[model samples]
Target: MTNYDFVIELFIRVDDAMKNMPKHSQAKLYPSELVTLGLLYAIKGVGERAFFRWADRDLRPLFPGLPERTRFFRLLATHQDWTERFLAEPTVLGIIDSYGIELLHPVREREKTLVREREKTLVREREKTLAPRIATKGKSNYRWIMGAKYGFLLNQLGLIVDWASSWIGTRPRKAITIPSSNP
Candidate 1:
């Protein structure tokens, strides 16, 4: 079917979904029309002005009550509660993904000890800063610099629900206790 036809179908579906809902008395557009436009905005996946233009140009015949550009968006914002009933249930499934960021490269970054040695005068004072979290296992010839690992949790719709960063967790330190000679 053509694009206009699809819009009409979408409106009908929204209308059917919200059949029990009542429209506000002073509202210019019907409840169904407003909800359809809102859904269209999301489905069209365009900026506000562009989406409005698409509707005003192509779907004006279907929605003659379409208001001014900014007003239409305002109405959509205010009347968003109407679409809640029609929205699908949030998916139970979610996805988690993580990535590593190399904040300090060995070539460009200096070790804490090296920095202290370079400035001998500063050696008497304790180092105030920490080294970058080190990364140990890469096949590349370049020495791996310290980095952080970041993770995101996304819902079924690919919306980010939460995220976290390992600010100092990637440091490579293993346990190795040495026996005292006196003992």
Candidate 2:
């Protein structure tokens, strides 16, 4: 009900889940403590400075061994991988969708199309190296998009199971399989 109660409960859950994670004796905060703080920061949806101030003022009682502001944040960042323990496993059913984002107009793409139409070989190796290759021509319902597209796979409970992104018209391997709960 209260923030303190919620934080304590969250810490308990995180600690129970992370029982296998080895903790360093020299570490100021336990792995669970750091994870609890990180989870709080994510759930609060506030800037680091504000979260630090709030924790220092309100949460100090809960986490008496709280480190200084910088070290506290650095610890969370360093051990971020620990949070993966909370990721929901892929279920038997899921939803998949994609969204296309436009970064630049298809000027270069159109130019290349026109050149190829004339049966002319392109010799713009230098231009190719200088272009932004991260985004490619992808299509959307509105029109052709000259950018990138991202796809999300969500389980029945709406938790993200997997995701992929690629150029338009190109498909990524669906390697994320939903195994039955038995195995």
The prediction achieving the highest TM-score against the true structure is 2
lDDT of 1 by residue, 57-164 (tens): 998999998999999988988886676474333346767676666666656445655886888777554343322324433322243545665666666898655556
Q: Candidate 2, residues 93-145: lDDT per residue as tens digits?
A: 88878788787677677776677566633546544774546466767867887
> Which runs of model 2 end up more than 4 angstroms from their true locations?
98-151, 163-183
- The TM-scores of all predictions, comma-separated, are 0.50, 0.61
RMSD in angstroms between candidate 2 and the native structure over all alpha carbons: 8.2
* lDDT by candidate, in order shown: 0.70, 0.80
Instruction: Quote model 2's TM-score.
Output: 0.61
RMSD of each: 16.1, 8.2
**How many backbone clashes does every candidate have?**
1, 1
Model 2: residue 27 alpha-carbon error in angstroms: 0.6
Error of 1 at 112 (Å): 31
Model 1 stretches with alpha carbons more than 4 Å out? 90-183
